[model samples]
Structure formats: C-alpha cells, structure tokens
Target: MNLAMKISDHDVLLVIDVQNDFCTGGALAVPGGEKVVPAVNRIAQKFANVVLTQDWHPEDHVSFAPNHPGKQPFQTIELDYGIQVLWPTHCVKGTAGAEFHRDLDIARANLVVRKGFRRGIDSYSALFENDKRTPTGLLGYLRERELKTVFVTGLALDFCVRFSAEDARKAGFEVAVIEDACRGIDLGGTVAATHQSFRDLGISVVGLEAFL
Candidate 1:
C-alpha cells in the first residue's frame, strides 16, 4: 500500500538489531532472520538519514537466561522494569555476536545507537531502556536533527522492531514499520499481538515497496 509514499529529509530509517546474534547460525537467531538484509539494503538506499540500533549486552546481563538460575531462553520473568523474556546469552560486548551482520550494508547509517549495555536493565526500544524511564538519548537526537518521522526495519518484528516503532510513535514521531524488511521471533503468538498493538497505536505497517 501507498506505493507513492516518498522518503523526505525529515524522515529517518531506524534499523534495529541486525547483529550477528540475531542472524542465522548465531546465538539467538530469529527464524529466517538473515533474509531481511537484502530488503533492508535495498530500502536503505532510498533514505538520506539512517540510524542503526544494536543490542550490545554484557556477559552478565540480566536478560540472559544463563544469568538467572533455572531459566531458559524465551522464558518470562519479572524484572524491576516488568516482564522480560529471558533470552539466550547473546550480543555480548566485544564478541562476534555483538557485531552487525556481515551481509548488512551500513554505508548510509549516520548514527549507531547501542542499547541493552547496562548489566541490570534490558533495552528493547531504541529510545528507552526496558524500564521505560531511562533515556537512550535517541529521542533527543532525533528531535535535535529535526527528524519528524521514523521508518523502522530489522530483526525480530515481535520484539526490538516492535518496541522501537511503538516508542517512536509515543515520542510523537510519525512511525512506520517496513514489514517485508523484518522477520519475527513470533514467540507465543507475539507477531499477531504486535500487529494489533501497532494498529492501536496508529503505527503504519507498510511493505518495503513503500520506500522503493
């Protein structure tokens, strides 16, 4: 839909967590996760402003299942912020899994915002950590640059991409998720739920063709 939609200078493409850990043959790969790379690369060329978000966690990060006794990846646990899905130990800082996917083309990205770096908090949204109170400086950065809209794409449609798009909309930016340029973890029907949430929040779910 909206094939005529055009990217403007005031819009920024926010690429989320296309890191090694979320790709094929990695620590916490989303199914068919690496498939999004081509779509992302193709659409990214259409944008003048781009921001890339990385999940940079520590070995002892609270979100990792290994950090919590008797916990497994994808298990839910209550944290100080709220319920967080325990994830496999992934994206450890300075590890290969923490690096961007080798096939990703980041030539157009002007900013790379790393999140979930704090050992105690898990950050899913690019604008804020899991607590929803701590700022990641992304909102102010976007505001200062006068970027009024955000087009999101990347790994795990049900988690990081979903949170980032929702937060962007909540922060008063026009937000859209490039559906074809994303893959979902789809844990416990989360993909369907995420689409519903996007609709409720007025976040557009658009195809990559919108940018093409």
Candidate 2:
C-alpha cells in the first residue's frame, strides 16, 4: 500500500487484542498469528490517532474454564447473561502473556483500553464490556476528542477484532477492519462466516491500503 495518503485527525486507528496470549505458543494461540506483526506495525506507524485495546482479565475471571467447577476449556455454559464459552486461562492481569505482542510498536499508540478486568464478565469490544454499555470509556473519549472513524487491526479476526469493529459501528463511527493485519482463532467456523458477520453489520474488512 502507498504511504502517500494522509490520515486525518478525526480518523483513529484501533489496535485490537494484540496481546501475547493470542499469539504463537501462548494461552490461545492463533495459527500464524505472529505473522501479522509486521503488517500491524506498519499500519500503526502511519496513523497519528492510535488507540490500543488489551484483554486484561483476572486469574479467576468468569471467562476462564478453571473458574467453573465442572466445566473445561472450550466448553459452552449458559449464564444469566446468555451463553458464555469457556476459554483457557489467558491474558490474566499482570501476567507475561497478558502483555501486548512484542512485535507491535506500542509507542506509537495514544490510548490503551484495557477490558475484561471484571471477574464476572468478559469483554471483547472496546465500546463496552459484555456488550452492555458498561463503559470502557473508549467511545466517550473518542467522542469527546471528536474522533469520527476508526480502522481496526489486530488478532483473532473472528472474535476480538470483529467485536471491536462491530462496536465501533454501533458507536456511530465509520469502521474498517484491516484483514491482512489480523489473525483469527476461527472458533466460530469458516473465515467466510466471520467475514460475513462483519459485512452483515456494514463493517468493511479490507487491507490496510484502504486507510493509506
């Protein structure tokens, strides 16, 4: 992609879930996830308005399978909030695996939104924790600062990245997800299914070139 284009101040760059837990050999590694580093870094450098989102959970966070008495990882359990899928313990607070991937150029970021810190709920979107408008303060900050659009790029295209983009759209911002700068766990099935889900909601999944 050409770097000649300029990114306006109203346009923000959303770095979604690039923590070590979602990268190679971590708690929830996505195949070839590490390969996205270069692309993410390059795209990040081109944007002046960048915000990063991290999955920060506790050791006993409800999302972890170990917290459930009889449930195991990858098992599905129903909660009052609806169906919650059990995930392996990952991105626990202050753990090495919870840190952002080493390859990312975080120094270029402006704000880092840490989510999923509550023991009873898990957060996949920067707009809210568990989709309930329990403020992550991201939307409010962006709105206060007058940021109108955000381009998302990071790990787990089907999960965190997807949810972030969807939430961005819901927050009344123009949303775009950089496909090549993301990697997915595919726990929800085919890549097409995930891409369709984003497209269904009007989120355009494209290369970083769009922003460039």
Candidate 3:
C-alpha cells in the first residue's frame, strides 16, 4: 500500500537509539548507522510530535557479553525469558557512548525515554523491556499527549527499532517503520526476515518519502 500520509500533531516520529555506540567507531556499530541521523533529523522537522529513545544499560547488565564468562558478542544464551543475545559493552549508563549521536537534532523531540537500566533485564523496545511486559511508560506518555500513530526510525532495525515498532503495534497504535531512516544489525541474515515479520504483523515498513 502507498503510505503517502501527511504529518500531524497526532502522529509521532519515534527515533530509537541513535546513540554514539551504534554509530561509526563505536563498539556495537551498525552498518550505515551514521546515515540515519540526517534522515531522522529531516523527518523529525516535519512532525509536531516526536519522541526519542535511548538504550541506557548498566555496566553489569545481562545483555553485555562481558557479564558472562566465555561469551562473545552476538553469542546467544538461554535466559529465563528465552534466547538473549550477548553484546559488546556499548550503551552503559552515564557513559559517552550511551549518549545520542552529536549530529542528531534532539531539540525537535518533545520527550526522551531511556531504557535497559535494570541490571537483570535488557530492554530493546521503547514501550517495553525484553520480557515484553515491563513498561517503559512510553505508551502512557503518548496516551496522555493524545498521540496514537507512531512512525519509527533509527539504529539497529532488527533489534531496537523493530521491537519498538512491534510493541507499539501490539499496544494498538498505528505503526510504521521508516526504512531509509533505519539501519539494522542484520545478524544471522535476519534483515530480510525482519521485514517479512514486520509485514506479517501489519506494521507498514515505508520509506521517508511516505511523509513527504
């Protein structure tokens, strides 16, 4: 379907984890990660409602590969919530790498939500932690502001952005993911599968042109 939709106050541009660590020269850099900032900045200017999310993890967070002996980044382990991917220490709380990319236009965002602070849990979605039930209060914030439709963008499309979009859709909000504004880790050839899953879930995976 063509998504030539116009922007409104009720439609939010949700920028997810476009942080220093996800960009070039950082520990967990995604391919073409830096390119997302300019696209997001341009897209954000056209929206009255905008929110940004950060992956703010603790030093000993369960998601970090260093936390588990003999584990390497991208290695999978069985946790209580099922499979969890161990990652190189990236977005630790209060660290420079945890901050948003310097070139990103954060001023356009009305609200910023930080997640993954819990030492025992890893959070990827802005709306919920990895468990899929732990609330990050993003849904309530949008509800209070009377915003419903969410256009998602930003770092690591297969992980954070994808999970956030899915959660927003499950929460009953109209959701679309801006493809050009996103970069994915694409671990284990998951990029194509991720887009398929997005379609299966009824989430519109569109380009920046949709809003133009």
Best model per TM-score: 1
Give each model's whole-structure lDDT: 0.92, 0.84, 0.90
Give me the overall lDDT of model 3.
0.90
User: Model 2 reaches what TM-score against the true structure?
Assistant: 0.93
Q: Candidate 3 lDDT, tens digit per residue, 133-186? A: 899999999889888789999988998898899898998999989999999888
Q: Which pairs clash (backbone N, Cα, C closer than 3 Å) in model 1? A: none
Question: Whose lDDT is higher: candidate 2's or candidate 3's?
Answer: 3
TM-scores of the candidates in the order shown: 0.97, 0.93, 0.97
The segments of candidate 1 whose C-alpha lies over 4 angstroms from its true place after superposition are none
Sorted by TM-score, highest first, which candidate order results? Answer: 1, 3, 2
* Count of residue pairs whose backbone atoms collide, per candidate: 0, 0, 0
User: Candidate 1: lDDT over CA atoms?
Assistant: 0.92
